[model samples]
Target: MSLQPPVYYIKSEYIETDTGNKVSRRATIAGPQNIILGGKTIISSGAIIRGDLRRTGPGHAVVISLGRYCLIGENCVVRPPYKTYRGTFNYYPMKVGDHVHIGAGSIVEAATIGSHRELIGDIYQSKFTIIKDCAKIADNTVLMPNSVVPALAHFAGAPGQFVEDLPESTQEMVEAETKSFYNRFQPLES
Candidate 1:
């Protein structure tokens, strides 16, 4: 008899999306708002997403948009930037691209992350990080605002910057890894 892959035992705290995304119940999405989820993204437990805040628009503007294959780690906060408008404070829209992974306890004020470094653990990521496609980050790296990371690379250190480019062979590997990570979390059958 053929064997099935062993089912991973995730805590009941996770809510799996129909499009293959896993959102931890403990994670704060702050519904009643416009937080877009691209596809196959994972928001780990304790993650806080401030979808309630955004700039004024046609009454249906989107804020904090996350792309496919993205991961938001535990206790991380994803919020849009805010500035004074007409003597009033307002937040702007933030967009995270595909195949991105942000580690735990990070504060995202920018619109993008991951040269594909997938910010894995606690990190200081600012609003100005420019990560190209297929980038990877080493643990404990702090990504400051206005920094740039090229594609197919690795990032590390405080105020984290793109430190090294991954070997070309790893490109396909990262793609596969992204798919695998998305598939790894499944809803427990009731």
Candidate 2:
């Protein structure tokens, strides 16, 4: 497989893509196993991605599987346990859909974050934090695990409360903000 910068690792594994993707110098991806990243994905600097996704029977860990065209911010720590058991193993693999934007320093694991989920700040995501598509999680927001954030909902605050239904005006504003932020530091295409 062809890597953009061609950085070195002690022991790393990846799938051979027909087309190469550009991985920024600022990004830090590490793991003991394979780091599977899809095509056209931008992994910025300071982003910590762990590749160990499987469980040792009863022992748990966070496995992050992101879809295509995802933008994961800098300094983000996404670690969530996939299985839990009170005598029996609770198997729940973390899954993120396409076109999702996860902000910096956000800890995401457990459940399924649907497509187009916009999350910001520090999320103390639990084993069952299920967010639907097109949901907006404000900066510094924390989503308690097992709680569901409805689609098109506008959430804000430290512990993340539903401010109100996400209006079109608010959506427009968020879109604009997102566009501007990414534009400022757009990844270089190889």
Candidate 3:
């Protein structure tokens, strides 16, 4: 299976990453393919991935790996491109773990945003903003680059700071709720 998105912009065509997989973008991708973007992965119309992917350099690549049932808000920019060097531009790969939710208009540029977190902001700009799982980011909060948010905390405001750590019990509740949601809608058995 090829994980490399085309270097150009594509519109309106449902794209399934694997070839010969019955689950076409228009059809249902099942089995091993069903596990990845095979089934529920939807790139809305006018959504462009790998726009002008640089063909050279070690890091001039865009890698987006979203776990099952992860929804990317419309008009959201995940891993936007940036200049890496004189002639070698690089595109940050958005590495989202399982069951994550990125608020609409929040820009996750080259960062490791953990699972089950809600990052709300007009422009969430950061490189390597490491937010642990089960975190809640308040609206319009600006998370500075290189910020590390521990798991199960509430964050708000510019350069978001930890307002509170979710008690272990609360964390367990969040995890349980999320697990239920994912398990219920997980791609039906092959």
Best candidate, TM-score: 1
> Which predicted model would earn the best lDDT?
1
TM-score of each: 0.79, 0.68, 0.60
Question: Can you write out model 2's per-residue Cα lDDT over 1-190, one digit (the tens) per residue?
Answer: 4423433322222222453333555666655244555544556557776655555564564456776555677687665455556665544556777667788777776478776667875655666788887788878777766788888897887676788787656545544544444344332233
Per-residue error at 180 for model 2, in Å?
Answer: 9.0
Off by over 4 Å in 3: 1-52, 58-60, 80-88, 121-123, 169-190
Write one digit per residue (lDDT tens) for candidate 3, span 37-85. Answer: 4224434332223333433655444555665445444456665435556
lDDT score for residue 169 of model 3: 66
Q: Kindly indicate the candidate among 1 and 2 with the higher TM-score.
A: 1
From the highest TM-score down, the ranking of the candidates is: 1, 2, 3
Backbone clash count, each prediction separately? 11, 5, 2
Which residue window of length 10 is worst by lDDT in model 3?
A: 20-29
Q: What's the lDDT for all of these models?
A: 0.72, 0.62, 0.54
Task: List where candidate 1 sits over 4 angstroms from the true fold.
Answer: 1-12, 56-62, 83-88, 114-117, 188-190
- Which of 2 and 3 is the better model by TM-score? 2
